[model samples]
Target: MPAPVSTASALPARALLACSRAYCAAAPRSSDICSSLEEQWAKIVLVIKYLGSKRTLVPLLTKLVEASGASTGLDLFTGTTRVAQAMKTLGMHVTSLDSASYSKVFGDTWIALDGETANHSELVDAISHLNSLTPAAGYFTQSFCIDSRYFQPFNGERVDVVREKIASDYSGTWLEAPLLASLILAADRVDSTTGVQMAYLKNWSHRSKHKLELNDPVLLAGQGLAVQGDAL
Candidate 1:
């Protein structure tokens, strides 16, 4: 295998500038804010919980990145791209690459910067509008069931709605990508299933209940790589 590409510090200034632009475009504010650019703030929190993600690992990853001294970093699998995103936040030029289409979509939307300003209110409104869709037609409905004791129908429905919005309208930008990634995490958190099985589990379904919030896409985030044209 070849060596990986690193985008840690080179892109930070540019990414930060893009984030500010997105903020301004979204809200039309004169003052600049240096917070996250994700539209679905709740989603980011939700993903952290669902993945039982290792924030502790951040230091380790950071150390590795720092040691490498690369201008850009590539996360081939890019699950949550948690470490990568963190590195980006800390002023790295990070590029998350994934084999899975969904994972790629999420990463592209969340981490890739448009290098432009954004409209916050309009983005929020857009999310709301996209969020109001039927459950079965959405992307997260692969293993959901209401009466099987696994997923509460209503709660599952809400998750489906949020997912639908993301799949439908997660454009490439600072705000949309992270927000959608967060929503992917949120849905995984509330899923009434065992971590081992990505599907719902009837027995433990009610043991805990979760409301649809923001999250990263579990399937995409956890996927392993398979080289194309390689035989099993």
Candidate 2:
């Protein structure tokens, strides 16, 4: 029998390069990837705090979506719609989907809100009014968790009042959505635990600074974009 060919001689010399080229050709062009939402999300200042958010995974998730050639993104269990909003900012077709009624409320506001005119002055004034309310005596008055180093407390009644005020006063196609999302974010920021409880952090030491600004959708509307419904 003829001598067996060496293993190295079995394949073409340029096999690796050829395979790479074929892979590249079959994949979607990087230029086709949407990136606007990612850029917009990068600019968001976390006003409220949250636990277990996927914000840190944003870059990885964005890259994965881009690589997977997903033309449309549906965010199921869309907590705060952070990832979905980012995808939307990227200009990818994005739908923020959720089952919870509260989530439904958020999705409607974030995904489908609109502003016809720029009202920076008006918005700033509204934010100012919303911030003036003090913590409720009934809830904040009672401490939830106390440690030697720190204590975590919440003004439940005051928070309720704020929610009520927003429900009654704030009106927009999308203003309330981002605004509520932002507030929820802020709540996450201030809470002491990795979970949603009025418990103090074991090592709590951060400046109590409050900053508020108009969220992305409102800004987009201000820029003359027409926003519509928060449907799937």
Candidate 3:
């Protein structure tokens, strides 16, 4: 005869029901389903465009960590921080390190965030205002895109505007990192590169012609650390 199942393991259904009730009780009240859906979507992972970004491997890697019974993870060479962000989403305490300043911006914004520090409405308003601003040629346009074809002039100008605004107005604030990350991701989306930004297409890709837009950076509520420097 098979051995009887232990009560501790067999009570998972009861435990899950209890957990669901607790979550429902703690959840904030929202007037509309659309607002609630938007709030939930904002907490989802931000899709990053990067050469050699390991976003597709996150699920498998996360499973391995869980199987190992590891509670903490350290990500070295955390470019774009997709893996670190994924691990954090799976409830691990993650420490992410990258040498690139741009990667550090991603790490600080997504991995290090512990709950919502900035007001959502205010952030949305700020993004809307930035997106509506008229585009103009600037350093980015001259250096990377319009002058060199790394990106189209329209998108390049938008990148310059958003970057300048974030640097001048939002720097050193809680809003800075996420806002900057959003801008970088936005630019990446419209870039006319096959993968890396080392070169651009002979002509503009359909994506490059689209107006640049910013989306909210995925913010995790779990504790994390972002380090910028050589991992060695």
Candidate 4:
């Protein structure tokens, strides 16, 4: 299979410049702000490789939002929170609402890290510490690996060990959201899934053979809220 193409090249220069021209007044001039946003969007590490992720469409959506003169965004069905995250990156105060518990975790992670320099520094460091954890056997491994071939035993064991550490140590802290999000992202990377969790591939995917590794979220400084509730 071919290496995956990034979502960055989705927008044409003409359209991107048009978006810059129509952007909000509070931020920098068109070219400068557009360049910054484009740079940031390219580097962002979305926490999930979800089935319905709006990752590719975010630029268009944000451009529309900017044209409307809205400085805030409400994503009612924020499945992977990618759109909400994009809006936040575009300097909007965003609220990502979804019924899924995991959606809330993705939202919460962004909110927790979009803080002062000191707090942001501390949070990232603590979350990064999860990488040092030793892999071990546990329920996640048994359920997702042994019982079902969703992930390799190596990656599954790492997820279990890290998850247990997150529960026992990082629970109730700001670290919880990003830490769990990182673990889930790591496991998903090495998973033998056909995108959704409904079933795993009969054979290990090339990606599945890789060891899991947590990636620290790229911090975007702005106001954000993640609510676990219906649109209503």
Candidate 3, residues 19-111, lDDT tens digits: the string is 544555566463364454433432221112234656557789888887988888999999878788878887888999999999888888878
What digit string (tens of lDDT, one per residue) describes model 4 on residues 1-232?
Answer: 1122333433454355455445634455566767766544422322123455566677899889888888888888987777888788778889889899888888887753574442666666776677778889999899999999989998888888888888998899877888888777777677776533436768676677778988877667876788998798
Model 1 clash count equals 35
TM-score of each: 0.53, 0.51, 0.74, 0.74
Worst 10 residues of 4 by lDDT: 41-50
Residue 101 of model 1 has an lDDT of 56
Maximum-lDDT candidate: 3
**By the lDDT metric, which is better: model 3 or model 4?**
3
For every candidate, C-alpha RMSD to the true structure in Å: 16.5, 18.7, 16.2, 13.9
Candidate 4 wrongly placed segments (more than 4 Å) = 1-50, 111-118
For model 1, state the Cα shift of residue 171 in Å: 7.1
| Order of the predicted models by lDDT, top scorer first | 3, 4, 1, 2
- Can you write out model 2's per-residue Cα lDDT over 144-232, one digit (the tens) per residue? 32222122344334444456667788755334655566555454444433223333445442422223222333433311111233545
Which ranges in model 2 have alpha carbons more than 4 Å from their true place? 1-52, 68-70, 114-120, 134-158, 171-174, 196-232
**What is the Cα-based TM-score of model 4?**
0.74
